[model samples]
Target chain A: MQYPEPIARLIDSYMKLPGIGEKSATRLAFYTLGMSDADVDNFAKSLRAVKRDLHYCSVCGNITEDDPCPICKDKTRDQSRVLVVERSRDIMAMERMKEYHGLYHVLHGTISPSEGTGPQDINLESLLKRLEAHKEIQEVIVATNASLDGETTAQYLAHLIKPAGIKVTRLAHGLSAGADIDYTDEVTLFRAVQGRTEM
Target chain B: MQYPEPIARLIDSYMKLPGIGEKSATRLAFYTLGMSDADVDNFAKSLRAVKRDLHYCSVCGNITEDDPCPICKDKTRDQSRVLVVERSRDIMAMERMKEYHGLYHVLHGTISPSEGTGPQDINLESLLKRLEAHKEIQEVIVATNASLDGETTAQYLAHLIKPAGIKVTRLAHGLSAGADIDYTDEVTLFRAVQGRTEM
Candidate 1:
């Protein structure tokens, strides 16, 4: 039997989210139905608040409440060294490390021809503008993932920035922390051996 | 660094859901931020609608948008045989099989002394009243889960209904389908052997 109207609509709405399927949507809809009125109202308000309050940072394309994000406006941060990531979420991953003091530039996406995403489609223009405007910026770290599209985008960015007389670097490839040497993949093992450091 | 105010609030709201952790909450909040404004509005509206519209079915105790749930109100179902389930969701599982044509009585919860849930706490009073009022009901198939509380609830229900000359039955227990013999536990294997039927 079909669910009641409101339940069905809620399930359909939940199905639009990323990684949520029919079963998960049904479960979430039912769970929402069981929630208290006050809690549900707060949840609904939170959903609207996300869209209503937050906007993209004009400087680096990161989502923020203000025009220039807190990260961009922070004078204490190392603005001379900027870490370029594929998405705003990547900034959180870097921040969790608590080591990097440099500012960030969110590309929003990588240059993927198969997915019809080109250099112009992403936030590349803003990154170039930011670099040109900020003469003190000495290094640009291309911290994209180690996928084909990521590598391609990194190469394209390096080609664009190198001619402008700015140093470009990619994240080092090696064995991950707590990973066993016996189970390590061949390519990573090769990189680890090739880039071995002398004590 | 922590997320902006709206984003942080959204993440906190998501973290309150069952089985969702901090990582999943963060992922969901970011995904919500990426959604279009129209999509976000629909999602928020759905959450509010669930709490605002749906309510308990007075007749069967199942949650519904109407007074009497569709299942309880249907004339085509076998009114003489009522499947007694612990929760409203259990009725959905039974209906998915497309075999059960009987009406249902949702108990809302089982009698669990450890959790402070008793017969009075659940929808048992309405079930007793329904049975007393409707002389057509001949059988009650207890479809509670195979847990300690479920077994206790079934026994209590049988003792209460048997005096009224109503046939009370419990769902059979055995090994589940697609389960490997090596991985199957001892108690289930014993039940499987004991409850073996002629082919």
Candidate 2:
């Protein structure tokens, strides 16, 4: 069905997101249409402010309103370890666990040969520069998801860090805490068998 | 997990919607944060404009930028039979069906005593005034949802309109097309039996 010009334009903009489709875009557009002028303005203002007021942390590449970001600048956080992740969302997840006191390095994306994504495509150079500048960093942990590209990126990072005399470890993979063996994916089952630990 | 002030404010705003939870709000907020400056600005502007520019149609209470709304002003549409619905969304749904060519009246809410909603709370008065003024109006279809409040409102309006000499009817209540007889609810089955037709 055809929508008015402004409504169509708004729907098209919403459909550009990674997961959103035409139906959802139309729903969102109609929802927007129902909103009061002030509320709609506020929503639009917030969207604009997000892009205007935020930037990537210079040191870690984590999203931040400030240059260094709160985590990177904190004097109490452990400086001898760094957790490398695929995106800022992963950084948010790690922060939620409250178990990580080290700093973070956001790669922005993984190196996927099929996707034409390589080491040079991501912010890997900054990580190397951080390694060279920070003498206190004794360990780097690769916390990317246990996917094919994630594994490859971890391996590549491990190799790059080894010559600098820093220990690099990938996050452990095994049977999930409550998962049934039969229902587990084949790759996860294989990893569980390969990384079998003592009882 | 705690976020910076601006981020927290934005997330809270997103969380105010019906289906959105704290985590989803965070995700949406971050997604907004990653958007381009122009995209963000446009989204914010649309939100503001939606609320500011659009006003309820004085005649039918449907949302509109103009006074009477496009449907009410259209000379070609049949105004003799008016379809009454609970909200703007319902109007959109009926429009999508493309079978109904009559005009519409948006109540903006259903008459729910439990929620402190009554006839006065919606656009019922305006609807009555429209019917009173228009002598050509022959039938009014109460197309509200098949819920307790919808039925109550329809019955109340039917009683109110009986003395005015205008025909009032509720939408047909029966097993929907393609629905199995066994799957239909008790109330629907009862209504279907009570309103049964000749072969």
Model 1 chain A, poorest ten-residue lDDT window?
A31-40
As for candidate 2, its clashing pairs are A36-B51, A37-B51, A37-B52, A40-B47, A40-B48, A41-B47, A41-B48, A44-B43, A44-B44, A45-B44
In model 2, the runs with Cα more than 4 Å from the true position are A1-18, A21-39, A175-199, B175-199
Scoring the B chain of model 2 against the true B chain gives a TM-score of: 0.92
| Candidate whose DockQ is highest | 1
Using Cα atoms with residue i matched to residue i, what is each candidate's TM-score against the true structure?
A: 0.92, 0.87
Evaluate residue B113 in candidate 1 and report its C-alpha lDDT on the 0 to 100 scale: 80
Give lDDT tens digits, candidate 2, residues A141-190.
99998888998899999989998899998888989889999899998899
**lDDT (0 to 1) per candidate:** 0.91, 0.82
lDDT of 1 by residue, A50-139 (tens): 999999998888999998999999999998999999989899889989999999999989999889999988899988988999998999
Best by the TM-score measure: 1
lDDT of 2: 0.82
TM-score of chain B of each: 0.94, 0.92
